[model samples]
Target chain A: MNLTLKVWRQSGPDDEGRLVRYEIEDVSPDMSFLEMLDVLNERLILAGDDPVAFDHDCREGICGMCSMMIDGVAHGPQKNTTTCQLHMRHYKDGDTIVIEPWRARPFPVVKDLVVDRSAFDRIIQAGGFISVPAGSAPDAHAMPVPKVDADDAFDAATCIGCGACVAACPNGSASLFTAAKITHLGLLPQGQPERGSRARAMVEQMDEEGFGGCTNTGECTAVCPKGIPLDTIARMNADYLRASRKSG
Target chain B: MTATIDRGKATEPVTQIPSRPRRSRRRVSSNSLKAVMAVSGAVLVLFLVLHMAGNLKIFAGAESFNGYAAWLREVGYPLLPHRGLLTLLEAGLVVAIAAHMYSAIVLARRAANARPVKYAAKVKSRADGYATRTMRWGGVIVFFFVIYHLLDMTFGVANPEGHEATPFDRMVAGFDPSRWYITVFYVISVVMVGLHLRHGLWSALQTLGLARRYPVLKASAAGLSALLTLGFLVVPLAITFGVVR
Candidate 1:
């Protein structure tokens, strides 16, 4: 299939970006979206032009590094699938694909189709971890965790940090992302020691990162490549309130 | 042709970017505000019911009605003392209204900015319930009505024709003959208020994380809307029908 690509191109973080057009023909249906882009880059190189830069590692969709806003929807039209897993077959021949980096105040564009997602890292660094001391690995079955609680914790642990939720959100809120982390650790026995402070610290960090407040629009869940549920956010809120109240 | 051949001959290793695990933080500020709205609204509804019931004393003639009013004034508005409790309740009401309005405005703004595509079709299907659909608009209308009501009742503002003064006199004048247009308008406004409270209550609960499952949330939302609508409408209809005079 032949497709026209409108790809965002930027020189650096400080530079303004614009969509530049490129045409690629003879794309195979089986080729993953990234592979097709690889073909286009090969063509660009032959023509003495710079190849389009995008972030991707594992094309298996678990990495969340392959972030792109295709046609205004985060991760394209596919539900619960990342961009790297999306294939050329999703588009018709001669389809004009508009590809751009994630749009958010925190995630600034670094180059073509690649934005610096370090703001998320900073938020995590602020307090998204369990404060366990360094020690020998414990037996796997030592701590007895309820099946239901473990299941909920596992569900919350699936966040991939792609910033797709923020890009999809109108206010660019990071509630879904932050909530998942808070709930995942807060549910475990190991996390109980610092759960209260952790919730407070993470919430304060989230606000400090300048992410907008959650409006319960459910768009985060809709665009989440991992299908992280919005209920996780509710859990985080309850935890935060409890933590803050106790501290107060 | 030479450039293409040279480009094909060149080789570079592909570097892999590591996948970073994202920590999801779901803030329940909106939900918390909704909870506040729901609880406060329920309290307000209770107050309104008792108020209407007290006003029903008019049906027993002037002595009973005025006596009830005098007793209320003398009691210094029990459940809200004239000085301390009244001040506290008034302050709390102001906070609740501010929070509710602030959260609603913010949510509305976010919703307005979130739509990525504009549909060209003339007919659009709405997935939201009737209450959710009209929340912002309904809230605005009710807000304006509340202001007008306070002015009319509390400050002894003249009626549309500038005839009546004092809340007691206005209440008697407004209900004695019960003008058809006034009755219709009052009924409609009260119905809107009911609609607003109904959905607002359930949604507030959901926001507070009380309703986790969608089915549970949906059912509660619908039930609350229906109950508030029915509960609020009963007294107004009674007055309009001369059942409560």
Candidate 2:
């Protein structure tokens, strides 16, 4: 399939960016979205022009490193599919696809489609983990986590931290991402020791990182490639309130 | 061209926390504000439902409707001052409204700061963006509408039909279809309220942590909001149509 691509080109973080159009030929329907971009880059190089830049790794989608806005939707028009995994078949011959970076103050554009997502790192740094003894691992069955609790924890742990939630959010809020982390830890008995501090610390970090507060617009979950449920946000709210009250 | 894979950076990744973790300090998290917003929203929802039920007395004829209106002012009887209960409720309402507006403004400012750069092109990711996009402007309209409603029906200033008249007669005259401008304003306000309530009800449930267990609660929120909106509008529509005149 032949396609026209309108891609955002920014030289650096402080640079003024603009959409540059490129028409490519001999595209394969079976090619993944990244592969099609690879083809475009190859053509650009042959013509001595700069190739379009985007972020991706482990193209299988687990890494969550592949972050780009395809058309309007984060990842792509396909629901629950990452950019690396999005296929060219979703588009038809002569179709036009708009590609751009995740637009957010916290995720500044580094070059083109690559925005600095390190703010997410700082939030996780504040609190998103469990602390245990520095010895041999305990017997997995000794603590006996309830099936329901374990299941809930595991479900929240599935968040890929792809920044799609932030990108897709109308307010650019990272509540879904922060909530997923809080829910993942707070649900586990292993996570109980630091639960109060964890909620307080993470939420504060999220606000400091400049992410917007959750207004329950429901877009974050809609664009989530991992299907991170919106309820994680509710659980985060519950935990934060409890923790703040306890601390106070 | 060789594939320029977004390599795993030597600087550790985020979202997926590593084996080693760091300690953190806490401030009054935004969640505190969210809780306030949720509680205030719930208060407003309860008030709307009650107000809607009170308004429906218009259908019961002049005597009952007027009696109910008068009963509201003297609810606590001789033990408490006349209109004392109503005054107390109004005081509570003022607090709730203030908190709601404050939280909304602060959060909106924070959201804007979060993403300093706007998307170069317009991106409406989903089909249902109308509610989210309209929330702020709709809120502004609703706020002004509430003020105008008080002037029209409470303060006896803006009511062309005369608020000094008995409650039933005032409502009947105010909503008479011949006065299309007033009816138009009333309809716009209610529709905006309906849209606001639709999103607000569900959003409040999530913020208060009431929505985690049952998915059906979303449907209930929508249904309840729609019912309340329709209930509130019935009086004006009926009066305009000459059904209750």
lDDT of 2 by residue, A1-34 (tens): 7888999999876689999999988899999999
Q: Which parts of model 2 are misplaced by more than 4 Å? A: B1-28, B127-129
Judging by DockQ against the true structure, name the best candidate. Answer: 2
Q: After superposition, how far is residue A165 of candidate 2 from its true place, in Å?
A: 0.2
**How well is each residue in A1-248 modelled by candidate 1, as lDDT tens digits?**
89998888887766777888888899999998999999999999999999999999988988779998888778887889899989888899989988888876667677888877877787788775566655988778988999999999998888899988887775677888988988899899988988878777877676655566665556778889899987888777777777766976
The whole-model lDDT of each prediction reads: 0.71, 0.84
RMSD of 1: 7.4
| Count of clashing residue pairs in every prediction | 13, 0
lDDT of 1 by residue, B1-245 (tens): 35454445356553433333443765444334444555666566566556667655666666776677556554655555555554565677777677667766765554454332221112111123566556679889988887876665555453532334534455645544446565566667777887776566555554555547776776775675566555555544555576664
Candidate 2 lDDT over residue span B1-245, tens digit each: 79876666765564331222333554345677878888998899899988999899988899989999999999979988999999999999999999999988888887887777787667765634566678888998999999988987887577766757998888887887888688889988998988888788888878877685545876776788789889988889999989889
Q: In terms of TM-score, which candidate is strongest? A: 2
Q: In model 1, where do residues sit more than 4 Å from their true spots?
A: A128-134, B1-91, B102-142, B148-158, B161-203, B206-209, B229-245
At residue B217, candidate 1 shows an lDDT of: 79
Question: Distance from true position, residue B191, model 2, in Å?
Answer: 2.0
